[model samples]
Target chain A: MNLWLLAAAVLLVAAFGPALCVAAVAAPERRLIAQNLATVVGALAFLLMAQGYGRSPYRDAALVLAVLGPAGTLVYARFLGVLPSSRTVLYGAAIGVPAVVGPVCAAVGPGREMVKVLVIGALLVAGGTVTSVKGDRHG
Target chain B: MVSTVIVIALVLVGGAATAAVFNRDPTRQALVLSFLGLSLALLFMAVQAPDVALSQLAVGSAVTPLMILLAVRKVKRESTDQDGDESESP
Candidate 1:
């Protein structure tokens, strides 16, 4: 019941619940938006869980997700013939990733671990931007 | 707190799985299925199995949905080609 795990728990409940509801019931475009939201929240929660569990390897899941999540969205957009114009993932990458990654990086201080955290954060933001901007071209 | 996270993850997994089951449309079912994958990964993480979670994230979140969508697209394309009419039929 550490602070990090508590945060992860709250985030999972608050974000994932609503995202699932929308993804299940809404239109494809809206479902894509919710899926984007879920991925962002899931990544952040993974980061928090890594910190809580005191295991740097756990963060790899978040890193893999940072790469896969937006790509998954693009797959949906291409198949569904509609790209969501929502910038939720972009906003989460810019704002939420930093808010979660910064503290973890600081806690880890200067080291290979810190660099890994930074790289994952960069990937998250980059993936989000790609999904958000690419939609403008297609949508 | 770990127990609490686990319980929450379990509930999410249950909800997402149920949603996937109840959705009749294949495309929409694919969306819910992805959500189910995400939650299942979360559950695996909560239970201290990051390895499983990582693989689940790869397969569930991305691969499964992609496969379903591609299959649906192919089926619709072939059906429309056979009919030679695409006026929003089915």
Candidate 2:
């Protein structure tokens, strides 16, 4: 198996699975936090999947997810009034994003595609920051 | 290798979908529904359909959950309003 696919599989099992389990059974606050974590993890997985398959177009889904994940959390906060701050997700993005995006960006090299990957990485970090900050204010 | 990723996605999607259905509260269920949306998008990507995955991420991850939450809130408000009216009338 390719390293990218192996990483994607590991991410799905290590991060996304636990996030899903937390979202399934935890209280509303915890569940929302888990949901937020899922988005970041899922986005990273998509990035890895795109690289694994050698398909540039597949990265768009990760881009869309980076933008949507925070917005979705805000929606839940508005309706449920339970926007607990998730430091784990914030820290995860801050560190995990570059860890994943850097390798992918290096693989793609200097180009418009590289720029796109950088932008998506920035978006993921920004989204994680916004959600965590907003949750602090609301919670 | 590809099949391994696909199988993982499939299992996650199934678990999320089942969780969404089993959760009795609309609000919590909405959360599971969004999770389900995300996993399904992953499944689509694993199967080599990025376009479908993109749309699914847009619609499933956010929009559907937002709609369900709004509907639940509206129904809850109306029920409370009716209860208030009955209490005042009696």
- Give the number of the best model, judged by DockQ: 2
TM of chain B, each: 0.92, 0.97
Could you tell me which residue pairs clash in candidate 2?
A: none
lDDT of 1 by residue, A15-71 (tens): 889999999899888998899889888998999999999999999999899889988
Model 2 vs truth, CA RMSD: 1.2
Give interface RMSD (Å), model 2.
0.6
Which tens-of-lDDT digit does each residue in B17-43 have in candidate 1? 999999999999999999999999999
Q: What share of the true interface contacts does each candidate keep?
A: 0.90, 0.89
Off by over 4 Å in 1: A133-135, B85-90
lDDT of 2: 0.92
For each candidate, what's the DockQ? 0.84, 0.91
- Model 1 alpha-carbon miss at residue B77, Å: 1.2
Give model 1's share of reference contacts: 0.90
